[model samples]
Target: MTIYGYRIPMMASLIVWCILWEIVGRLDLLLLFPPFSDVLVALGDVVNSRSFASAVSITLYSYAWGLGLAIVFGVALGFLMGTVPVADRLLNMWVNVFLSAPLSALVPVIMILFGMGAPTVIVTVFMFAVWIIALDTRAGVLHVPASLLEMARSFGASRWTTTWKIVLWAAMPEILAGIRLGVIRGVKGVVIGQLLVSIIGVGALFTTYSNNFLMEHFWALTLILFAFALTVGQLIALLEARIDYYAGARS
Candidate 1:
């Protein structure tokens, strides 16, 4: 960020927002907005509680399973769509439709199909995340330089060998970009799933806190979720940066 020819750190803006929140909270602008300090204290308390631990574990477990499957299938399908025109022609419209659709509405059908459990939550996360990853990966693969593919063919590289060694490497930057975006979406998916499916895990905590008007606890839990998403996003962004060479060279 910058202002008046001076650069501002990212955390500076966060601090500003925190101050505004604290002011509003102190003034009782909204009963739902608790004081930042009180929220911090509640956060500390929740962090040590067994319920919190269990909730975190359950949420993370579902997140991992969903994201893992998303990556595997997303990348594979993306590769196929990128390399095979027939496949892309067949599936492109459906993929675009899913990406543009309100996937949340499908949760009820998922619940009916999968039943009320972690499986529903996992599927929700996957549904929310997989499409964007596949799209980004496909775009990346399509952008791989034709010369590179010709070089691989000139070297007598088999289809599999060219795909893994040349095409995959060339698309690594955008693939990582897709994964990072998918992860952020997955966080939203997990929350939505838990809240709608059975109110298990962190959803339960949110329900209890909000129903009882425990604003501090509710905001504290929200902050934790936001932090988790931000941390994972930054990590993946760093990994993407490390593969910047591919993007630059391809261009």
Candidate 2:
């Protein structure tokens, strides 16, 4: 009755790891690393703190908005580059330049320009993450098999029709992979932006705790961020798995 067979084992492994981590942390051989129970208590405290809730909400909001804008423009630009040589030529240099540059260093510049807060941080994250999505999508489109295109065209498929029907379907696996990578990088960029450009988020809290040598708080916040990233990554994997199953099995 199962549509796919992989989910149960993966979920079991995740649960096992969490249990093991809690047990190990509770043993507490390391003075600096607090028990998982303590971390949970801290999480509860942070969750109940209005200031922490507000900061977390702002961070999440900025992350969603920035990532959304990136996807919109990135996908559009990617499609344009795939279809138009001039678009690729005009964009290639700048794209590479931005990608190659140390964008984390320019957080101060972003702060100066945008004058602090979520606006600057979100922009910095988008700047760091968008190029990967655009470039990968463009490459995926270009590398699609010519035979597929010809077949679609032979059926008198219009330009738009071919793009949507054949090109997009073929490129989806790769495009989704790019999105997965971009999302992870975007999360990291958000943390970096929060630390450097603003004084908020788990990143900022982690910095403050570490600077004050509050190892328990530092590690607790870090664990939360790690869990967040892992959750996002797993969601992306689930999406990709679903896409592959639908596209591959529907002969």
Candidate 3:
């Protein structure tokens, strides 16, 4: 970030927000926002509680299953669409529709099919994340150089070998980008799924806190979710940086 021709670290912006939040909280400017310090204290309490531990375990379980399925199916679908024009023509419109649609509205349909349980939440995450991943992967695969494909063919590489070695490697930067985005969307899916389909895990905690007007605890929990999403994003971004040479090679 920059101001007045001087660059500022990104963290500085977050610090400024915190300072503002603290000031507003101290002044009791909003009933929803308690003092930042109090929320920080509540954060510790929330983390150490047994309920938090259980919630974390359940949430992680659902998240993992959902994201795993999304990756597998999404990558496969993307590969198909990218490699086969027929598949692309058949699926492209629906994929774009789902990607642009209000996915939250589909949660109730999922719940009806899967019932009010963890399965619904898992399916919700998968639905929320898979389309974007497939779209990005298709884009990446489509961008793989024709020269690379020809080289693989000249080397007498089998179809699977060519795709696995040349195409996938070249397309990896965008693939990872898609996965990173999918991860963030999956978090939202998990939260919404749990809240609506089954109030267990962190959703339950959110309910407990909000229903009782535990604003500090509510904000603390919100911060934790934000931190988790940001931390995952940063980790994937680092991985993207490491593999960025692939993009440069493509160009």
Q: Candidates ranked by lDDT, best first?
A: 1, 3, 2
Candidate 1, residues 156-225, lDDT tens digits: the string is 9999999999999999998999999999999999999999886899989999889999989999999999
Candidate 2: regions farther than 4 A off: 1-41, 245-251
- Per-model root-mean-square deviation over C-alphas: 1.0, 4.8, 1.1
Better of 2 and 3 by lDDT: 3
| Tens digit of per-residue lDDT, candidate 2, span 1-251 | 23466445556777787687677778876766766667777876666766667778888988887788887777777888887999899998888788789988888888989987889878977987788888888987887777778888899999999998888877776677777777888888888888877877756676777788767666667777777877887798888887784346323
Single out the weakest 10-residue window by summed lDDT for candidate 1: 196-205
lDDT of 3 by residue, 1-251 (tens): 78999999999989989989999999998999998999999999999999999999999999999999999999999999999999999999999999999999999999999999899999999998999999999999999999999999999999999999998989888888888999999999999999987999988999999999999999999999989988998899999999999999889
TM-score attained by model 3: 0.97
Error of 1 at 17 (Å): 0.7
Least accurate 10 contiguous residues by lDDT in model 2: 1-10
Q: Each candidate's TM vs. the true structure?
A: 0.98, 0.79, 0.97
List clashing residue pairs in candidate 2.
none
